[model samples]
Target: MEAAFRYREREGDLKAPYEHTEGPYPLGRWLSEQRRTFRAGQMDGERAAELEGLGIVWDTADAAFETNLAAARAYYRLHGTLAAPRGAAILDVQVGQWLTNVRRPGGLGQDPVRAERRAAALAAVDPDWNPAVLGWTVDWQRHYAYLAQLLDEGARLRAVTAGVTRHGEDIGRWLVTQRRDWARLNPEQQARLTALGVTPARVVRARQAPAKKRSTTTSGRGAAAFEAGVQALAQYLAREGGGTPGRSHVERLPDGSEHRTGVWLANQRQRRDRLDTGQLEALAGLGVPWAAS
Candidate 1:
């Protein structure tokens, strides 16, 4: 008991290393034996009370989990989310690897009650700490959190250009990809992004006016025309699957508007060399696989 008291006073916790000794006494091994005895309900009531009074933790694993949970909270406070990569750590705790382990099926130990408490604690730290969705990964969630932070800071979505990055992730490029693959996102994911002022790209033509600034007007018109072409291609794919259309083919959309989709597609292919990476990616995501090449 004297040796245990000395170790506890020095370490600030009862979690001593297995090889730890207090002077000539193997205090760590003795403490482990006490925990075993306590678990088996074989420890004397008086002795158990003494150890408990000294703040002895009978469950070393639980103590370790609490330590790691502190690290996770610190990480979240710093990064705004618990979507840590595989090697992320806080001080001495391998928080990222710990999160991965606990997120696994049946990884929270066999005690149902303890698991529930641990899960609740983690959720309190960050609700999406362990994403429950099938396709949601830590990397995706991390980027999303970063985007959310930028939005909260009043950053405009359109102004986040390809080079605008946060924590090594090109959020602007990611935003573009999300807009391009809007149809591929699950409803919940779409709803989340929509709530954050993100939406699928659409063609918005400027009102016709006198040629006061033809250069700026022409640039705007060109972008609107390209978006219109992309919209047509998307509609054509929805109706006709992946088959390429003939040059004379025309598609009548739900809005009762006719698009010369075949000609538009051919023109886009001809001008593929001029398309930006985002534009090409948008086309590729819409099933125009050749755009990727």
Candidate 2:
């Protein structure tokens, strides 16, 4: 036990090599025996619990998945997406290569249930973990995620200047191209941009008229926010099957950005009186329980 403790302390986990030793003790062999005992139902309950506390991973496959998952989560937290280039790495983990392989069919494993579970775990980390699975390119999703972040931070769409960039993507250029070629975008892309207060170039030019300038901002802001909320709710429904998200639930969008859908839902319920008929109808269409009020 002392050898096990010392090994765990130094190695961060109990998976020592079979030939490993802690001084004179055959700690690796001893740990292997413990696993055998546990599997045979001969190990004491308290002893099993103690080993678990020491991070004794019973299954090597699950352990590998968990280790890689930690690296994926860290990368997502930093870049907001798992769309890593093939050469990308987080510390010692080749997260980019791992993600690339996992995105392929049967790359997780041959076992259906385990593969589904692993895929679900990755999805929980980044809903659009595989951009191809959602009918979009990784680069497109990355750009959209940056735009979503900017909007959520209260940066108006028009204020995204020509030199603006995020993660080396010229978002300002992307925005201009998106607006100029709004018709070139698929319905989903157009809907997402519209939710963020973006419009066609022609409409934008028309709204630049002084007579409509003030009203445009005020009206666009509320409508865009509401549309974003609705889009988030719809996405939640698609991902979770049903039931509302809790207040702390942060929804990862297809573009790799997160939306505080729970908070938005709560705010909507509290301020239901301020919503227009069309907005209310939109929420009701999504089967929001409180929207009927």
Identify the candidate with maximal lDDT: 1
Q: Which stretches of candidate 2 lie over 4 Å from their true place?
A: 1-57, 203-293
TM-score of each predicted structure versus truth:
0.54, 0.50
Counted clashes in each candidate structure: 0, 0
- lDDT accuracy of residue 133 in candidate 1: 32
- Candidate 2 per-residue lDDT, tens place, 202-279, comes to 854444444322222126677787777777776665433346889998877666778899999999888777676667
How far out, in Å, is residue 144 in model 2?
0.7
Pairs of residues at least 3 apart in sequence or in different chains that clash in candidate 2 = none
Model 1: worst 10 consecutive residues (lDDT sum): 210-219
TM-score (C-alpha, index-matched) for candidate 1: 0.54
